[model samples]
Target chain A: MIGVELRLMLRRRRVWLCWVLLCAIPALVAVLLAVTNLAPAPGQGGAFLSAVTSDGQLFPAAALALVLPVFLPITVALVSGDAVAGEASTGMLRYLLVRPVGRLRLLTAKLVSVGAFVLLAVVFVTITSYIVGVLLFGFGADAAVGGAGGITSLSGVVLTPLQLAGRTAATVGYLALCMLAIGAIGLFFSTLTDSPLAAALGVLAFVVVSAILLPLDAAAGIRFYLPTTHWLAWIDLFRDPILWRAVREGVFVQLGYIVVAFGAAWANFATKDVTS
Target chain B: MAGQRFSRRWLLVAAGAAAIVGVSAVQLPAAALDVDAEALRRCIRAEVPPYVGYAEASGRLGLPEIPQLESVTTLLTTTTRIRSYVAGADRWRADQLTGALGDSERDTYHLGAAEYVWDFGGNQLTRVLGQAPLRLPRAGDLLPPDLARRMLGLAPGDPVTAIPARRIAGRDAAGIRLVPTDPDTTVGRVDIWADPTTALPLRVEIAARTGPTLLVSELLEVTDGPPDPAVLRPVVPPGAGAVTASAADLSGALRDLRAPPAPARLAGRARLTLPSTPGSDLPGVGVYGTGLAGFVLIPTGRDVADRAVDGATAAGGTAIPVPFGRAARIGTPLLSVAVRSTGRRGSLLIGTVAADVLQQALLELPARGRPS
Candidate 1:
């Protein structure tokens, strides 16, 4: 069933569109910066993006930062929001329920498909940006900017290319899990309603509201538990020593979100009446 | 007989107790001396930094702030003279007295958010109405106790011992010295001379690991009289050309010849912190390292850096290879400056720190032409 769902997701033009959009941003930025004379302000952006104006090898990292804040999550939310709600709205869920496939198994397969889309979207962004950035900015020696691990680590050293690659993969994986947690929330909301658009908007609204509250000093104490709080923790991967405390905490928080969200989705679908 | 034997043992015990008491009595004065030393340390700690002295001077000398001094001071090892005059907090004037036959002195001034340069021989005073005024370095900052504490990287509980008193310019002063606690730090030691009465630092000497004093600032003369108010104002000669530096101006005229614009962790090892300065100097001075091993990156326009480098090379300075570009080691062991150019701008990496540390800074600092 998971394989079938994955095949269906891969066959969708919407999923491919999201990937194309994600990949285009980095390439566009790379080309624009190459032709233009725009320079990033002093001490702006992460170590990698800051390096983009100097070396093109960092363009992919810069592009990832640009998309991570909004685009990637939006793509994840759209895919997950449509999972159960889209089928139910089209009157297909009632027919699928008649088959031998259990409601819980169906929910799992939908989640896996959404999770696969999240992975594909992120990988597309990273790989596309890397190729475009290198083509435009010419690969140079690994220039470590600040501190041991560069931007995030307490150590003031730059990581080797192999180490950087490993950290980047880990960061991308963590980002994927974070997106999966968001997708699970969207799936849970999808079970609540038959409108796919409404489910997607519900997930986006939570993210937007959390982002708004995160900046208020008064909400600082409780803000740590918000789903959006650790969205940028992947930046620590760029640090030379790879600061683990925040990144580790981020992973745990995402896992907690996934557990609650997936559990709610399972309970809802199990008991939900499929009359549509 | 039993009673007599017991009485004798008691007597021996009383004798031992009395001996112990007598020894403690002899050590009482030593304990008192320790108390005095602690008091001295506390007083020195409170009075040494200019922050405290500034307050004391404000109360004692019926003045708004210390009068800005514009006087020519000769470098310790070289024939070059630097004329520095600071006014109205941020307004500054610095003139390099180049002893050339036909070349007049070059002066850089920052007046009311405007930075400009005056070439006496050329009869031109070019002003930068650029995005911001370039921050210039000051001589007074080198002698502050706060900077000394940071340079030495001292913890509150760090051991700071007293050096013998010295008579500096006729003022009797005691010196407090801090040695680097971290073995990895390149700094050897820092000595701050404080007036015993006022607790203000009279002189400061920073030394390297090899025991050569890297920099020293001492009062050559003393005067409590208020400075003439007339000299406090900068006088620009008539008919000098005025030039405005635009925001995008990357010309040698208005490069951000200041330190790093923001706090940066350099070469992924140490954080470069901006040293706190009074209103007189602009707030862009960057000092890297909390330990002995650190360098100061003074941003100068490419012209200034090139001139200095050329001047040093002409005087038989050695060229040192760096990752970005070649740097020059001007002067001997007594005084030297390593000049490196980056981002089309030039930075002078000045310190007694090891050459490798300077090289690391040169390799990692952002290129000078804007962010790109």
Candidate 2:
């Protein structure tokens, strides 16, 4: 059942379009920077943006920062929101349910497919950004001489190319987990209505409200539980000692969201009346 | 069958609600523990523990920005978040976290005799060579333990009494209040809370006699053990720009400008000799008094002084009469500054003393080219 869901997702034109648009943004940014030779002053632009001009190897991290704020979440919401509601709107859900597939198994398959899309999107962005970064920035000055030149951590400690690769891989994994939590919430919304747009809008509103409340002092009491509060925790992975405090909290928060949202989705779908 | 399914759905909702309540319940205040106030005070002064912690400090003094003092003004009027790892008095590292989301960081590592400063935003590492007798303030100075210890050391004669204990950073902390009896001092009271067992200060609050609280620094989370040694050692990255700088360079700039010498006595207070250290005996700078009531006198160029006075006046400073020139005074709840211009040179007097004290000191400053 999960294989069928994956195959269907792979063949969709909408899914392919999302991947292309996501990959195009970082490539466009690299062209602009290479042509103009102007990088924002240090600490002025996105996280690793200023450093990207000096060593393009850092562009993957900058690319993630550029998209994490809005682009990535929006795509996740759209794909996951349409998981069940899209099938229901086209009158495919009733026929599938009549087949001997249990509601729980069907919901599980839909969730697995959403999770796959998230991983695919994150991996594609990381790989494409790396190619664009090195082609424009090169391996920096020391790499040419076979010296110790590599990516510099936020703490001013040098990271070898291998270590930089490990950290970048870790960043991709952390972000994939964050997006999975959002997908779980979107799946829950997908079970609420037959309209895919309504389900997607519901998930987006949840994210927007969380983002708005995260910065308010009065909302501090509830900030810890907000899913959006720890979105930037992956930045800590690039630190020299790798400050794990925020990253650990972020992992726990995202896990909690996944468990609760998935549980709610299962409960609602099992008893949900599908008259259509 | 349908009824059983409905119960299952309700069960999931109940479990989610329970999880949130349980998390919030863990953060509720713990009951305070009884402790001897005097014993805790003595323990804090005598026993220093090695620990690692995260702290937050905020000041509401609203100090105006001035040239060459922008850092000082910001430290006194804004919030600072610091992560500190301490093994001893000389071996420690403080990382000041900034930016809207606390993503940017500047770290200072103090080894036995060497100091290194790393800027994450600029990707630069600086090794400080020497110490400056009079240095500007930094984020590390606002750490709860450091700030509490310094304030206690400065006013040793002040009376100390017990205040109600409170919970801080998940610890049952005992509190002490220090009230300065000196009429000339502007500080009203200082409240410090510490762990009774280790006497490590967890929180410090300072306020003026007649105004609102001025500064509050507290440890948000802490652990009671020395951090890994490798964490305190800063390695300069290969591609990072590394440079060596002298601490005295800032003060040396002032001395090269050749301002007038400071008076030996101002407002009946004799000039206090600074501790004799390398590069500290800069001529023409005077430190007055020996306690929290004391102030420093620096002779500066007329333009710098004028700019400071104008900044202060625009921030609600008041004009004051002085010998042979003009003077203006500005004050927060706990700090006072007076700038006086005499001929082509001027003097700046600043301290945690009363505004009138600065006014009297400014009146006694001699005109340039005149004998004291």
Candidate 3:
């Protein structure tokens, strides 16, 4: 299954190139950020500008702004949106179906590869950003707990550079989970169409709809529980005393969506004839 | 057994004292309107109009106040000079404001100062720089013990305290209040005047022992968002050619100049009054007296310039007090300001402390001559 997935990916150079670009863009951005401090000087009103601009926004608009609209969704759509369609369009999927491998196993392998690619893409972006951030921002005791206790930690806390990297790794894990739902939806749609562009576009269209709906005056109640809303769960990484409730909910919701998406794909692909 | 009994007795005594102190807090006279330091800090940020200190030249509004633009730029400046070891050649000019000190590369830093510019909206530093007729946030009655006491009975050299109340500026205020006092005292009682709708002060009447100095400051302009960065730059203007760096000059820290404005005089019969309330549409009832010569009651939307014009319109061999004092000036003054946060207990006084840096830089200014 791994050999087949590799062959399939290599056959289409554009997909390979996209994976490269996805990693490269963030790395380049990280480099630029490392070279210069984007924040203004201490006294010249820079701090206020940084603080006041935040809203009840679900994501740190800065990181997500760079990631979601451009990288994550684009990558997801390219891979998941083209899964079944690309195979059908190139006429290579049939030869495999006639082989000994079961249909379920075939879908599982492609999905795993898609999952691997998503994790790889997110990890690269995370590491690149971290390196750049550390270089430019320096490890200046990131926070000074100026309360009456005079900055002692109640629990064990880590301060070494290596520890920071570990902490950041956990944060990236949370972010990757948030994007999983987007990739799931794309995977579901990949089975719905024969044209890769149509499928890819369909995935983006789904994201755009949610993005628009999230802000309208009516997105309360059950509507707030939409898939993309969970996509913004990454901001939980920054809050002190991390709100585990929100993180737990986010994880479960994406898991729920993944189950439902694959369930639908299985039901549809299992029964429908693929003669065309 | 005897030692244990003694220790227990002492612990009980300490506990009793703690209880008594707790009871005193509940019984304090100001308990009804009493706000903790944190609540007061929140109020201050919420109520006070964010202030931005700006002073720059060229391609922007210079420190020079415009004739009458219906706005103002609250600005302050600070400067610093540092000398470091040179690597190969001493190429860095001493006059230029450059160099990172933390790394310690022997790069000398000179004229390293920053300006805080609050445009129309009146930011604590940046947030409200654009919206005009600003109704500053109420820093609340959460002043520290000394400041609260000083604010209540403000005197000359005492800091002034202000809060936003509904009465002053109609509807423009979130709740606006302003007070002015010397460095010695934090603001005590502040008279707030703002049109809630316009958020502009109709009058800001400050009561102090030195006589109530009323600021009839008008929101002449509110250029929303940040002022132009170039306007915030401290560099010399075009054709203001840069001077060469001096190696032998350790006089970098020496004061460059001092030019506090000469006290302006009012005509002997001139009068300035600050009516307590119902003082017209002004933000407060604060008034300014020019050495007791004459008094003019300053109302909101009425600049001293407007008052001067009004005095002229009255057609009299009369006198009007100069607005905003005599407009103080100092030539290339060097300052050393220390900002101690009054915002939170330990959260650096982000907004209020900006003033300290500016104040310190001006304190140890250089004399009249350029240098020895």
Name the top lDDT candidate. 2
**Backbone clash count, each prediction separately:** 15, 0, 86
Please give, for residues B205-284, the per-residue lDDT of candidate 1 as tens digits: 76655646656655433332333344334334322344555433423222343544633655344545433323223332
Of models 1 and 3, which has the larger lDDT? 1
By DockQ rank, best first, the candidates go: 2, 3, 1
Clashing pairs in model 2, backbone N/Cα/C closer than 3 A: none
Error of 3 at A174 (Å): 2.4
Best by TM-score: 2
Q: Give model 1 RMSD, 1 decimal.
A: 26.0
Query: Which lDDT tens digits does candidate 2 get at residues A1-276?
Result: 999999999999999888888888988998899999998876577777877887888889889888887888899999999999999999998998999999989989998999999899989999999899999887765364334337777776677777888888889988999999999999999999998899889989999999999867568688888988888888878877777777887888888888788888888889889976
Kindly report which residue stretches of model 2 are placed more than 4 angstroms away from their true locations once superposed. Answer: A141-149, B1-11, B28-34, B58-70, B73-79, B99-103, B163-172, B182-188, B207-216, B220-225, B250-273, B276-372
lDDT of 1 by residue, A1-276 (tens): 999999999999998998999898767767777888464542354334535654455566678777876888898888999999999899999998999999879999998898899987887887888778767776443343322222221122234556767776887798889889899999989998999999999999988998899766568566767878888767655533243545787887787777667777776677667898
List the candidate numbers ranked by TM-score, top first: 2, 1, 3
Better TM-score candidate (2, 3): 2
* Tens-place lDDT digits, model 2, residues B146-246: 88888888888787898887788888888999898877788899999998889999999999998778899999889998999988988766567788887
Best of the two (1, 2) by TM-score: 2
Model 3, A276: alpha-carbon shift in Å?
Answer: 4.1
Docking class of 1: incorrect
Model 3 spans > 4 angstroms off = A6-12, A30-65, A135-138, A141-163, B1-372
lDDT of 2 at A125: 93
